[model samples]
Target: MKKLSSKIWSLIILFLVITVVFMSLFTNFLYDQLYVKDSEESMIEVGERLQSNYQGGKVTDEFVEKVEDFNMYSTFNVFAVRNPKELSACVPFEIDYDTLIGPEERRQLLKGEPITKIGYEERFEREVISVIVPLTDQNRLEGIIYLYYPLARITELANNEVIILISSVVVFSMLLAFFVHKGLGHIMRPLNELQHAVEKMSDGDYKTRVNVSSKDEIGKLSEAFNEMAAAIQSEDEDKKTFLATVSHELRTPISYVKGYSEAIQNNFIEGKEKDDAIQLIHREANRMERLTNELLQLAHSNRDQEKIDVYPMVISETIRESVDLLKNQSKHKEVEINLELDDSLIVQANEEKLKQIFINVIENSIRYSNKKSLIYILLKASGGNAVIEINDQGIGIPKDDLPYITEPFYRVNKARSRADGGSGLGLSIVKDLVKQHNGKLLIDSELGKGTYVTITIPLMEEL
Candidate 1:
């Protein structure tokens, strides 16, 4: 349930904290291994060097005086003593002889072996590192040489460096967090806007949009979101327009049928007038039937694109067949359809749908053509496509209406009687069928000149 930015910031802070802790631990390890160990070894060497000065003789004042004089100038506390109790006067705390030279340590000291000690010494009130070397003469315990240094002085060498390193790391971490926070803010701004826009869209505001500020992935995502919003808004508007137009088209016919049926049932008209009323009702019923059928076909074409079965066939065959089927109607209109086709031009398409495309376009041309005019149909191969052009020498469509000619129920001449012009869904059906065939449909027309329809479908590859 946590937000993305919060999770990211948490991870960043965790990483920095872990990094600083690990570095601090590693620095302490290095200080112990490199500095403290080296100081211990140096103390042992100094004690051994002082032990070599003892010759085969009894303990003497001259040797002790020489050790005290060396200790005055050196960092180590050098001691040459005959007994452990004599060294007790060097510090304030009372010293126990057994604790200073334990049984095991006494044995090693008598054997002329060096002993190193490190830890807290109550006598010194701090941690101390000391090395003891026995001054043995002729295998007899004579005296002992001692060299000790405060452990704090050895550690003090690197404390300042370590402190500075940790301080710098803390400061750097703060700065990194600051910049990362700002960067995340910049990056998530577009995403936040997109989230709000999506919420608005879910609540029926399809027109909501987000701004695109950069060419990065986030910017591209914003652009895609805006495009999707625009498409949804357009689809919503189209649905509303479609519903309103459908209601208007059906209302008139329903009113006529209702009024006429009621009049007849009530015996308001008789004889020829009754027959005429029945005929008018029949005509309205037929118009309504045609509109419903066209609407169903349009919906099927949109949904059935993936279901259409396609095969290779000669493009000219479908055109010629469509022209032949429409011959009787063209004859009634006094319009002639002429064909100029390349018989070898083949395309991959559904045969029935291709024929439907041709029939719809050809019938449309015939319906709009001037009497006794010629409709030219041409088929040819161009750019690996089978291109078909249907041009009519009819009352052409206005330039402004050309763009919307393929919209269902759209008519170039809105005031024209539906019975004379036929339903305006023919070209819309043609367009969908052409698209189902993976073809492009282009219509160009000039008012009073003519309308030209071009359809291009991919040609089948020769095996």
Candidate 2:
């Protein structure tokens, strides 16, 4: 349940903590390697040089005097003691006799091995580095020379550098945290707005949108969100319009059939009048049936296009068949359909759906054409498609209405009425079928110049 910001900040803090610890350990290692090791080597050299000056004789006051003179010019505190117990006199405080030179150390000293000690020395009251070189004569310990330097003095330079390093790390961590917090806020701002807009849409506010201010990923996300919102709003409006249009289209026919049936039931008229009323009822019933069937076809066309099975088919033959089926309807108005076809043209499409597309467009051309006018049907291969262009010398659509002619229940002129114009769902059904077959449908027209519908279906690849 934690917020994204909290998780990101946690990771940043963890990284900084690890970096600070690594830097501290690295500085300590450098101090030991460069300063402490060199200081220990220097002390050992001084101690051995003094031990060599002993001359291999019994302990004497002259030898002790020579060591005392060497101490004045050296950085280390140097001391010479006759017995091991006398080594405590080098410092101002008392140290344990056994801790300084135990029985094990005495044995090693007699054997001529020097002992090096480095650690905290309570008597000196500081950490110290020291070396002990033995003076021997005739295989017996005569005396010893002691040398020591305070560990703090030897590592002073590295200690200063470590303090500065720790101080800089602390300051840099604080600054980085401040900037990263602000940067995260800047990055998350657009995402937050997008989330809020999505919430509004889920709550039925399809008009909600977010601002796009950059060309980055977040900005692209905002643009996509806006497009989705616009599409949803358009669909909602279309649904409302469709329902209202359906109600209006059915009301008049229902009223006519109802009024006439009631009069007939009461025997208000007989003979020819009753027969005429019955015929009118039959005609209205047919209109209602046709409207219902077209609506069902339109609904079916909106389904997933992947469900439509398609294959290579002769598109020119389907176009010719559609023309033959509609010949009687065109003949009623004395309209002639002239065909110019490329019989070899083939396309990848569903046969039934492709036939329906041609029927709708050609019928519309026939319905709007003047008496005795000629309708042109041309089929040829263009680019990689089988192109079919149906042109008519009919009353064409206005420029303003051309764009929306394919919308369900849209008519260029409402005054022409449903009875004369047929159902306004024809072109919409045509558009949907064309899309299902992965085809393009383009309509170009001017008022009184007739409409030109161009349909292009992809040709079979092998052909």
Among the numbered candidates, top TM-score falls to 1
- Candidates in order have lDDT scores of 0.86, 0.86
lDDT of 2 by residue, 1-463 (tens): 8878888989987987898799779878877897788888888888888888888877788888888788789988888888767766666556566877888988889899988887786766677877889999888888888777777743455477788996897799788878988999998898888889999999999989899989998899899999999999999988888999998888878888999999999999899999999998888888788788889999988866557999888888898899999989998989999999999987888889899999999999999998999999999888888889999999999999999999888898898846684779999999999999888999999799889999989899982
Clashing pairs in 1: none
Worst 10 residues of 1 by lDDT: 88-97
Clashing residue pairs, backbone N/CA/C < 3 A, model 2: none
Candidate 1 lDDT by residue in tens digits, 1-463: 8888999989987987798799779877876887778888887888877777877688899988898788777888888888766777764445466876798988898788988877787766677777778988777778788777777643465578878996898899788878998999988888889889999999999979898999999999999999999999999998998888889888988999999999999999999999999999999999999889889999999888778999888889888888999989999999988889999887888889899899988888898899999999888889999989999988998888888889988977878847563677888998899888889999998778788999999999889
- Point out where model 1 deviates above 4 Å: 56-59, 83-86, 89-113, 123-125, 137-142, 153-189, 214-217, 304-307, 421-423
